[model samples]
Target chain A: MESFFTDSPLDHETLRRSVEDDAAGAVLVFDGTVRNHSEGHTGIVALEYEVKLPMADKLVARILEEVRTEIPVLKIAVGHRMGRVSLREPTVIIAVSAAHRDEAYRASRKIIDRIKHEAPIWKREIFADGTSEWSLGCTACK
Target chain B: MPKLVRVEIRYYAQLREDLRLSNEEIELELPATEEDILNRLAQLHPKQAALFLASRAAVEDEYLPRGTVVQDLRAVDVIPPVSGG
Candidate 1:
């Protein structure tokens, strides 16, 4: 089964524990963390992220469609969190279960890369110096 | 007298912050080029002037070359190089 979650905090333990089967030999998980610094405006404060909800949902659905059709995986689960998050907090998680290690590894890597490139969400970095900027990825500090 | 057409503008990321706006509906005189809109926007939002000068404009979600005809001027998205991974 393939799962996608956008609202809840990504549960790493649950994902790893749940994605199991006697027929499957491997399960891979990828976790994305938010780092501090991006786009030349760094004073070390906080970040606020927003997304066009409808658009983001549709985009994720499309990515999952591609993953299922293009990747050889028995099951996949992906999640992304929206709303205020602090530095080093987990923002995205992907889990893949397959008959072999290679399939799980490949699918998990592709899912995160595709999401970062295609997702409609944006993050606003607020500096302690009262300056702020926006970036697509964490540590975009340039 | 000159004809006027409605052009929609949508902003994202840094451009949105520069313009201090998300979107807008503007009516500009016909035969108006993107440069004309850029100049006008510069006047309306001086803070975005430099950003607009450095950035490119899109008409109907596609980049319009400099000196291109204004045509109907619908669904213009003023974009920056905010496309990043």
Candidate 2:
């Protein structure tokens, strides 16, 4: 298992390789990238990700452990990017390996979903208009 | 004399933007609670009061109950709703 929060751009290939195993027949990967539009806003410039580093690191580890226990996966690796991510740039990646395709796919799905909702990372959308807004991930803040 | 305690407050996302502050240090009355600290922050930044009231507080990396005494708090992170993918 591996988890990281870095200001550097994410490398999906590196994450996939980290979870590669000889016994595993399937290696599934999920990449969350910055898109060009959100809601009704178009011509998006980039996404800014800010995190409470210590809490985020701890939560990512917890999520990885929980997912591993629930799924019979051989290996798992997850990485999230901090700082600014331009359009089409990846913000997060989750890779998992298992003896079969089903386990790998399911584990990868669960990891990403949990990380999005449970982690203390936040994202802001920067539009081409030079305006930005925080994405609503938690109800209390909205 | 009543002692004063120092608490560090860290902001994130929209709260940070609204207050134009990433963090701040405040001296509070001794034996203050998390709510007291938040209320104090709201007073200092009235424009962000609603956000403060809606946010959650974590002290020393642990989620703090509203009524928990904060005399020993070294820092508090005010977390807005998280939106990550």
Candidate 3:
């Protein structure tokens, strides 16, 4: 039951261990990273993401509810970052703990997909030329 | 004169900064449809109108089908397609 907005880099080891608690039989973690090329652009420097906290939280809650009903998730953790993130850096992390491996895997995948499609967050790409452009595939804001 | 119906307007992402507005409380004449509001918005702010024309919309958090009526006003979130890394 963890949901937070963070600017710090992701701690993968901490997340993996945290999800492997006493009651959990299996834990699955998925990481999303910033890419170098997007929307036919080159010379990409970094990306900055932002979200409307209240609305984003609501959307996340809905996704969590779905995960609870559809999967055997005992605990779930989701963290996303804002501000500047360098290439190859993690932007989103989700951990799912369940009694079985399948549920954990499915829940993590579902949650990540839903977050990408529904969250109100936006990312801006900074180019080496000191200009920026918005990333594509953002169906939520549209 | 027809009764005035209040519809709340909101913009997010680049469109918000482009419009120079976040949200506004206003009353539109009753029987006003979504297009009516869109037309008025275009008249009020052409740049935002272009943005809206290029984007999609959601009413009360749910994406509405094309040409839905705006009788109740409620809450409208004008969303533009945003990208993530």
Candidate 1 residue lDDT tens string, A1-142: 3545454566787877677777788988887766665555455455666664555566677777898798778877776777656667677778788999988888887777776665556767766676666664522322
Candidate closest to the true structure, highest lDDT:
2
Q: Assess candidate 2 and give its TM-score to the true structure.
A: 0.81
| lDDT tens per residue, model 3, A58-128 | 77888888889988788888888888888888888888889989899899988887887767788888898
All candidates' TM-scores?
Answer: 0.67, 0.81, 0.78
Return whichever of 2 and 3 wins on lDDT: 2
- Residue B4, candidate 3: Cα error in Å is 2.8
- Cα RMSD, each candidate: 5.4, 3.3, 3.8
Query: Which should have the higher TM-score, number 2 or number 3?
Result: 2
Question: Which ranges of candidate 1 are over 4 A from the true structure?
Answer: A1-8, A38-46, A128-131, A136-142, B1-5, B27-85
The TM-score ranking, best first, is 2, 3, 1
Candidates' DockQ values?
Answer: 0.19, 0.63, 0.44
Q: Model 1, residue A58: displacement in angstroms?
A: 1.3
Which stretches in model 2 have alpha-carbon errors above 4 Å? A138-142, B1-4, B27-40, B65-71
- Ranking the candidates on DockQ from highest down gives 2, 3, 1
Q: Write the per-residue lDDT of candidate 2 for residues A9-91, one digit (tens) a residue.
A: 89988999999999999998889898987765678889999888789898889888998889899998888989899999999
